[model samples]
Target: MSTTAAPAGSQIAEITSSDASLRRFLAGLPGVDQVGAEARVATLATRSIKTSAKAFALDLAIRMIDLTTLEGQDTPGKVRALCAKAAHPDPADPTCPPVAAICVYPDLVPVAKDALTGSPVHLASVATAFPSGRSSLDVKVRETADAVAAGADEIDMVIDRGAFLAGGYSEVFEEIVAIKRACVSPSGGPNAHLKVILETGELVTYDNVRRASWLAMLAGADFIKTSTGKVSPAATLPVTLVMLEAVRDFREATGRQVGVKPAGGIRTAKDAIRYLVLVNETAGEDWLDPDWFRFGASSLLNDLLMQRTKLRTGRYAGPDYFTLD
Candidate 1:
């Protein structure tokens, strides 16, 4: 994908009305043109991504992990060290389990990749001017391409909220399409996976969330993410439910599988569990894999360890090891 600026007035993803119901719904709503941010989303994400014995045993288990310690120096050595810790914890907890992927910023993709050399933990980098998609298209694409070239196994790019809110669906669609093309991995075994963040905090209503969720999926998003964690109104169970429903609907319509990521403020084990339940109930068994579902959290790892340590050993592990991702 060439790094080019956006064409003025170009619409993003195309919305199709299969029937009267959908057409009426789209016609009645004031989409990107009439949205306003009011109440902030206060839903805190906890380590609730656990499953029942049967669900854990029978269904594919995906653990969402975070390296929430982004505050310190983001040097390569530090990143590599942290990645090593993520792959092989200082103290292994059988109950804590293994995370499917390790998420970090674009600058740290290589660090994470190097740190997780032989482990199954995929390196995921946040792209598209993450936490905010207001940068030039060229810059965004360069960031994504660089991250992938640096060895990121997955690319988590935030969508252009401004374009989406302005009813510019084509802009959003084209951006994702280009970014996905840019995500080719180092060896080219596979391009980095794309997870489009809608910043559901910005997409207020359930109807709009559902519509945008489907739009991102159609635009070639491997995963539909909830928020960027930078916004106050981040991921919420209710909003996430709407997103999962959208994915389910999209699956029914196109027979394609897509993923969902609920990021921002997911703190404890309980919160993660709730999201897992919603995904399990709404999207069925197909959406249960780490490849399809992820929790973009920075703090949940520690809480889960603490909980697991308490449960298994009847002692709480000190919080010194957990860092904010």
Candidate 2:
């Protein structure tokens, strides 16, 4: 697979499709000091955000959420309920902003789309054999196209970590390129935004996380995501910090800004605050927007709503106040 040019007028790093070139680029990236990264995240986690700052961070986190439901038991009713929650997370307070997107299975795209009609919230679908990229290239491409046809505004595709771990750098890069191509509409225009999931929990090291982040960015991922939520240790603070650094460095190198989504296991207002702190300090204030940052979570919204209620009402609100979806 030859290196393709970045979308017209977009700022993207120039990368050769050759395996040797890709290896050199990966090798040239600065080595991540795990201890240093961990220490930094710990220190940032301690930053005292209170009162107005805490309130701002709370709402920002809500808007940055990619509310998700990916399960074998999902039905249209379930998806519609999730979509309603995404549109109005807190019905008690109209001030609460809707989440950035509602993420679901490809087959549920139409269900979510119709539910989200007349709202700004986007519909996202996980494709390319989510949680495990153990399918053929043709299958992955077809899955992406089907999602787009069904009305998904974004596609979250998981990379083949088995191949990446096997030192198949070129294969991983080519796979990303192929899926990126598949994101185009049938009418020959841009379709869904592509988010490449690295499943960093399975990558096992900060160094691998950094490398995978760049590889996905080089292949034109609109966003680089961290997990699928099926594995343990998903979306840890240290892993997200490294990815934030990767996006920061990639922007410095190519002038193109790629978003980051830390999915799974991030379920509390405090946990969400820690991640917001990491983004502010490492990725800078520029990434504070929902467009550049997102949290892929299912149960996280309820917690955020509960906290928001506390902030507004001067007392903690029970879970019943928020929708159970």
Candidate 3:
């Protein structure tokens, strides 16, 4: 499907001008078929790639990783090491592609920036009371600005699920818009890309996932992410399928193309490839690159490395061969 030009600013504004309009628009969205979605992902999961194609997929999967580390104990040294690993995933193999970006807590953005300076791997910071978007709007906005000022190429912000579930759609929408504005550099340079996390596990249903996806895109999110990796039942194939469908339809309506990222609980090479296939099948080949899709994972890189080694050398490498994330 081809993407047409986006509607004028006035038309976009009318849709989100008030809570009633936002609700009416969101309610009008087509409901998701839970069984059909689950069935589709189940069928897609069984399709296997072989030999040369598998190699390509492994490398591509490696390139799509965000290489994240967001724990309370994360130190500058840890952030630097993660950045180093992101720059050169498998140091012994020069052919191994670097990850798409390095995701860290906002406080560690400076450390990561220093480590990843001159590297192609983008630096991402989780802001806006990340993993739990339960803070004052002022605090969230300030945190987003701070991360951007400190050198974050991307900001992964969590939407207030409490407000969303309480039917405060306008509150969540306005909050996202405010944070999107905060992404701009103080000097008026390029804005840091915004990835709005739906935290799908908390969202409770596939229908809600679709609504939240549309809500985020409408509010100017560059990417609609599945989870923060903190919640249970994170980033399942069926959930990702719903999000992929939202983005595909979104692009058709708005000229702008949005991205999809399935974070948390996605660890194995097989799991990562399954997500790649899901994106290819649901969102089309337009999103096959790292620019349009990503896997927010940490241990996932090591697994992809091990699988890549097995494919190239005809044997599996021990986990010890790669650095721990």
Q: Which digits, one per residue and each the tens of the lDDT, describe model 1 over residues 72-188?
A: 366777677667656655345433446767777787776677678888778888888877788988999999989888888788898898888877766776788789889876575
**Model 3 C-alpha RMSD to native:** 2.4
Q: What tens digits encode model 3's per-residue C-alpha lDDT throughout 69-131?
A: 999999999999999899999899999999999999999999999999899999999999987
Largest TM-score belongs to which candidate? 3
* TM-score for each model: 0.79, 0.94, 0.96
After aligning candidate 2 to the native by TM-score, how far in Å is the CA of 111 from where it should be?
0.7
| Evaluation by TM-score, superior candidate among 1 and 2 | 2
Model 3, C-alpha of 17: deviation from truth (Å): 1.8
Error of 2 at 25 (Å): 1.7
Clashes of 1: 29
Model 2: CA > 4 A from native: 1-14, 187-190
Candidate 1 lDDT (Cα, 0 to 1): 0.68
Q: State each model's CA lDDT, in order.
A: 0.68, 0.87, 0.91
* Reference-based lDDT, residue 222, model 1: 90
As a whole number from 0 to 100, the lDDT of residue 135 in candidate 1 is 98
Error of model 2, residue 263, in angstroms: 0.4
Cα lDDT tens digits, model 2, 1-325, are 1121222223233344478877877776677888888887888888878989999999999999999999999999999988988898887788999999999999989889889999999889999998789999999999998998888889999999999988788899889999988888776555889999999989998889988988898888999999999988789999998888888877776778999999999889999999998898888999999989999998889998888888888898888777776
TM-score of 3: 0.96
